[model samples]
Target: MADDAARYLLGIDVGNTVIKAVLFDLEGRQVGSHAIDGQSTRPEPGHVERDLEELWRNASEAFRRCVADAGIEPGQIVAAGCAGHGNGLYLLDGDDRPLVGIQSLDTRAAALAEELAAEHGAALHAATLQEPWPSQTPVLLSWMRRHRPEVLEQAGTLVMCKDYITFKLTGRKVSDISDMSGAGLLRMPECGYDDELLALYGLQGLGHLLPDLIDPTDVAGTVTAEAAAATGLAEGMPVVGGLFDVIASALGSGVVEAGATSIIAGTWSVNQYVSSEPVIDRDLLMVSAFGPDRFMIMDNSATSASHLEWYVREFVERGGHHDDPFGFCHRRLAEVEPRLDDPYFHPFLYGSRLGAEHRAGFNGVAGWHGEGHLIRAVFEGVVFEHRRHVERLRAAGAVIDHATLSGGGARSEVWAQMLADCLGVPISVADGEETGALGAALSAGVGVGVFAGYEEAVSGMTRIRREFEPDPDMWAHYDHRYSTSRDLAEALQGFWSSQYRDARRENNGEEEAK
Candidate 1:
C-alpha cells in the first residue's frame, strides 16, 4: 500500500533537562514521540553539567523507544535532524572521546564574563555582534583556559549540544550556522569561523577545535553503523545539519519571514524576530544567523515559566495535584482575575538581563491573597518579563505587530491569552505540541529533497491551531503592572548584589573548611 511505502522524518530535541525524539510524516503530522528527563549535577554552586556518557545513553534510549512506539520499520525513517540548547560547551578530547558537557544554565564564568565585557565589550560586539556573558560558549571556553587549562590542552573539538548529537549519530564533527552563530563563535553577517574573533576572547590559538560548519538544511553525513546499532535507525540514513532550539521553535511556528517574532516562554524567555538586515546594538542580547543570509535578533534571559515549575516542584508536588501539577496550576490561574492591587512577582529564579545577581520574589503579598492569586501573579510576572524583551526588540527597530507563541506557556490557553493581552500583539499558537521537533524534521525534509526549501516546507507542513487577539480594554491594566514590575526590579538590584556576595563568601568558607 502507498501508506506502507511512505517515508518519515525524525527530529531530536536536546534541552538542559529533557531529551525528546519525535517522528513526523511528510505532511508534518506526528507519528510517535518519546521523551526522557535527565538530571544535571551540581558539583559546585553556579556550575551545571551533564555526564556525556549519560546524555548519549539517554538519547539512544529515547530514539529506540520512539521508533518502537511508532510501530514502523526503522528503515522507513529516511533522514533526521537535531535541535538543542545553544551557547554551552561540549568538548571532545584529543582521541575524540567525550570530554565534558557544560550546560547553558551554568554561570561559573561570571567574573570572567564581566571582565571581558568591561575591557573589550565594544571590540567583541563589533566582531561577533555579542558581548561576553557567563554562559556564552567563548566565555566558558575562556574560563576553561584560565582555570582548567588541562581541559583545553586535551580538547580536540569544541561543539554545541546538537553538534555532539550529530557526531554520535553520523560519526562526523560538524555544526550548523545557526548554533555556531547563536553561540557567538562565528563572525556575524559573514557567518563563518574567524580566528580574530576567538583572539578577542583571549582564545587565540584554539581555532582548530571548532567543528566544520554547514547550512541547517544541508546533509552533513550519513548515520554510521555504530549509531544504528546503539539506536534503532538504519545505517547510512541522511542526517542534516541541525538547528539551535530557539530557531527551531521559530521555524516550527511558521516564523521564517522577516519581522515575524517568536516568543518562547520555557526555561528561558526567548524573544526573537527574523530580519533581513543585521542589527547591532550593545543593549541587545544577541544577533545570530537565521537562514543563509538572514539574522535572528534576540533579547532573552533565564526568566519565564520556569518560575511556575520551581514553585510546583517545591510546593505543589507535595500536595494532592502531584500527578498533573501543571494542569492544576492552569486551573488555579484561571480562577483568579487581574486586579489593580494584585501582588507582583518576578520570574527570575535563574538570573536576569538587569544583572546576573538578580533573584526572583513575590512582592506585596498581602494577607488576603490566596494560592490562586499567587499563581496568577506568577503567570503575570512571566508575561511581563517577555514584554521586557519585546520592548527591547521594538526599541531596536524590529516590528512586532504580531508574533507566534511556543513553549510550555503557549500550551495553556489562559497563558497564551495573557501573553497576547500583556504584549498587546496578536499571538498565534502553532498546531503541534512539539514545534521544536517539527522544525528539525522540516530541516531534514529539505536535506533529503522531500521539500525544496524552508519556505515550501513550512507552507506545506505547518499550520496555526489558534490565534489570540489582544484585548484593548486590558492593555491599560497590564501596562500599569509592567511598569511596576520594572520599577521594583530596579529597586531590588542593590539587595541582590549583596546577597550574591554573601553566598560566595559562604561557599568559599565551606570549601576552605573541607
Candidate 2:
C-alpha cells in the first residue's frame, strides 16, 4: 500500500517580504510549512527592490525546512508549484545572471505611468484591459529602457516573481498566462503577446525578453540535480508553470466559479471576481483567469495592509514592543471608542488608484487622540481602500454578494470584522493562513493529475473556517466614514499633485524643467 507521504505536494508562495514553502496532502490539509522573511532595499526614492540571489536562498531554505518539518522524504513529494506577487520586473542579464529585482511596491515609474496614461490610455486599455500603472511590468520595463537603457541592453528573459522561483527550481524560463496577462504584457480577451502593446510602451524589439507562456498547470520543467541539491528536493520532481499570487489566493479561497469574489488584503488591495466574459465598459484591471475562457476583473492598488506594516515597523517596533506587535495593535484597537469626530487616515503609502501623485497621511488629528485611535484609523483606512476596489468591480458589473478574504489582514479578527462591516457583505475566511501556497499546490495537483481540474480541486480541498456577516448597526457609521474619507481624498488631490510635482522638480531639476 502507498504511504501517506506519497500523496504530498509542495507549494511555494513568494511575497514582497515573505517566502513560504508549504506541504499539503491530496485533501488540501496543510501538513507542514515554513516562512522566511526577505529584505527589500530602497536604493533610491520610489524604488523598491530585492536581491535575486537572496530570494532564491530564502526559498531554498524554506523548502528544506518545510520538508523536514513535514517529516517526509523529498522523493514522496509528487510535484511543486510557485505563486508570487504579480507585476514586478524580474530580469536575467544576457549571460543569464540576475540583473534587477524590482518588487511591486516600486513607484519609480509613477511620472512615466501618468504620461503614458495621458498619451495612450485608451489604446492601452483597449489592448490589455488595463491602464498604465506605476508598478506595472511593462511600464517599469519602459522606464528601464528610457532611463537605464544599459540594463535592457544586457537583459535576457523577463519573468514575474513566481516565475523567477520556478526558473530557479526547474531551470526553465517560463510564465503562465495569468501572470503575463496580469502584467499587461498580453492582449486581453484572447490572451496572447502583442507587439503593439510593447511598441506602445516604447519597448519595441524586446519581445525576446518575454519568457515562454504556458498554462498554469502545464509542466514547465523538472527539478535539476543542482536545484535538488540546493533545496533538498528529489532530482526529478515536476514543477508546474505556477500562478500569479492573487490568482493562487483566489483558488485557495475556493473562488473558481464565476461570480465568486476574492479580496486579498495583503501588500496590495486585490479585489476581483471570475467572469465568463471580460468587462470592457470601464477601464478596470483584469487578467485571464486560471480557468479557460474566464477573466478575473480586478481593481487593485498598492494601498492595503502595507501601510499598517510600515506603521508597526516604524512606531510600534521602535518603541520596544517586540513580541507580537500586531497583537499589541489589536489590543489598542479594542480600546478605541468609535466616534464621529475620530480622525481618518489615507492608506496610500505606495501609489493610489485615484492618481499617481497621491500620498498617505492622517487627517483631522487632534491632541486629544491616543494610540488606539490612530491604530483604528489605520485599520479603517486599509479597509476603506479595499472598499474602493470592490466598488470599482461592482461598477464594472461584478455581483459581489459575498467574498472570500485572505492574506495577512484575514488573520486579524478585528480587521476582518471591520472589512465585513464596511463592505456590508458576508466575508468568509479560509481554513489556512497560507492560501497562496495552497493555491499553488492545487496547480501542482492538477499538473500531475491528482485532481482533474481547479473546480474539483477546490471542492475537495478548501473549506471556510469562519464567516462574518455585516453588522447592520455599523453600516451607517462606515458609510458616513467612507464618504468623509472619499471627499477628503478628492479635496487633497490638488495638494498632492502640487507637492509631488515640487518634490520631483527638486529631485530631478533639469528633467522637470525640460
Task: Tell me each candidate's TM-score.
Answer: 0.97, 0.97
Using TM-score, give the best candidate's number: 2
lDDT of 1 by residue, 106-128 (tens): 87787789999999999989988
Query: Per-residue lDDT of 208-307 in model 2, one digit per residue for the tens?
Result: 9999999999999999999999999999999999899999999998888988999999999999998888888544766555647777888888888888
Report lDDT (CA) for all predictions.
Answer: 0.89, 0.89
Model 2 lDDT, residue 142, Cα: 96
Pairs in steric clash, model 1? none
Runs in model 2 lying further than 4 Å from the true structure? 1-5, 510-514
Error in Å for residue 151 of model 1:
2.6
